[model samples]
Target: MRASRLRRAFAVAAAAGAMVFSVAGTSGSAASGMPAAPRLPGVQADTLAERYGANDDFIEKSERAARRMGDTARADHLAELAEPGRQFLSFDPRDDGLAVEVLGDLAHADRVAVVVPGSDTTIDTFDELGTRYAALAGGARAVHAEMRRLSPDTKVAVVAWLGYHAPRTLSRDVVTTARAQAGGAQLRVFVAQLKQANPAAPVTLICHSYGSAVCGSAVENPASTAAPLDNLAGIAVVGSPGMGLRSASDLAVRVPLWVGRGADDWIAGVPHASVSVPGATIGFGTDPLSREFGARTFDAGRGGHSDYFKPGGLALHNLALIGLGHGEAVSHD
Candidate 1:
């Protein structure tokens, strides 16, 4: 009876999330001003300076476009994020959206952390001020600050990679990996570009919630990739439902896998299994923090779902340690 009730609750939540995704999806197409990226051969930017400059240029154009459309809120937000000292790896402002910001200098950094956010994240959400608790950009900034503080000597950079369409937390799409498949491909390309831009720097993927599914799918499928993933040092998943894989071995990445789950996170209740339906597969498989997943579990304290990157939280501390490549400093269960 208890298990049946849980399933019913998930079904309802999934339905709600699906409705939200539908609304967001309709608006998203008009918001991404640029066409889909072309199939380029080499680095997207010849140098870090060039990348930053190009992004700023794009932001300026986006700002003007936003004003023309009478979206002053978006214009103002872009203006703030496009300040002189800020560096963006990429920026596109159209309907719903994609923006990748570098929290620190990527060119000279010894280690870099790429943060992938989960459900209900959109460019509008990314631009919203004072919602750091719920925004990917704010979360990235906080994580970057913590990384700098914890590893003072290590020049670390954090990239807020809002590159994919995140599903709604209460929708049916949240239960499937279809969006994750597309997101994973995009992530793979971005990571490949990063590697080509800076071959020596160690890159770690810090995937949160549903973002872990993206990372998992990207690494699991090798034949679909244009470039091989040889630059990653580690992959850390926080507050995840699952990674669409049964075990760490299934991820097929030659790096350390770190998994963390906060005590107060409701995702712990998500069934750690998957089932195939007529059109698609529902549910991601094997919780990352579970022993059968073969991932190194860490102590993420008792914070809620979004608290992994919260300032001074144990999860943030551990994440910073991981971002800095100081695995020894991370606390284990």
Candidate 2:
């Protein structure tokens, strides 16, 4: 059984690697003969509509450039993403990467949820406009909808943050925390800037899969003197392999730490261990949902790996509960 799992892991990784190359290769602005997107407005904007307008203008320019370069598919894609009312905090046509969008009114939000996605999440696959289960953007919208459904009076916002270069499942990079380290720094800075703009709004980070490693890295390193992420109100890691830490204590954060995993998630089969490679340590250590690791485990239901944010699913419900500072109210298995 152990050998079979290892074989499956490698097979999945290989398949993931090839697909990623094809998708990511399409994102190069110079290679595609498209100009770079303009610099985005301040991400920490107090007026949500104003920020959306600025980003929309840049998206339109980039889309026009793509069309001029004869890449109509990309141009069309950008047009859909730039639809007038959508709230985009940033836009970069470089790697088709790191576009942040708010699902609700960020300006008056009492609570905010920042979604950190896992592997295979590029801008191309990040926003499949109408499909709810296929993309991170869909999941973020679902979460926002659920929050509104459950608590109509509460003003909440969900940020779909494709803020890092996610690794392919089959690549060697996936085995290491290297990418997570860089992503974590960016996330930390983003959260800090968020606090600066909305001092009264509490923030919760919803990390999925390898994105948990990014969240973990952003907090105290234990080995370093860097301060912990005290600005966050809470953090929830779902379908996590591990957080690049043996225990939650290693994160050194003051907020409540939550963990959950779906019963059918293939990640449950991956051995929860970390090893040192030539240049980096591969794999995150320790199962986060394990009692020994000490996270508040919540119910994620019987969905598969990518089903956590399903509109009416228990996982999404629990996530909404946690994001609203009702962690204790979250249902468990």
> Which residue runs of candidate 1 sit more than 4 Å off their true CA positions?
1-14, 17-45, 127-130, 224-226
TM-score result, candidate 2? 0.89
Give TM-scores for every candidate, taking all chains together and pairing residue i with residue i.
0.88, 0.89
lDDT of 2 at 333: 80
CA-lDDT, candidates in order: 0.80, 0.79
Could you give candidate 2's per-residue lDDT for residues 1-333 as a string of tens digits?
Answer: 443444455457657777776755555454345555555456564555666787788778777887887877777777878876788887677655568888887767899999998877776677772365547888888888888888999999899998888886667567678999888888887787677657778989999999999998887454454433555899999999888878878766678899999999998977777766467765687899999998889999998888898888899999999999998789988
Report the lDDT of model 1 for residue 264: 94
Which residue pairs in candidate 2 collide?
13-170
lDDT of 1 by residue, 254-298 (tens): 798899999999999887777776787777888899888899989
Instruction: Report the Cα lDDT for candidate 1.
Output: 0.80
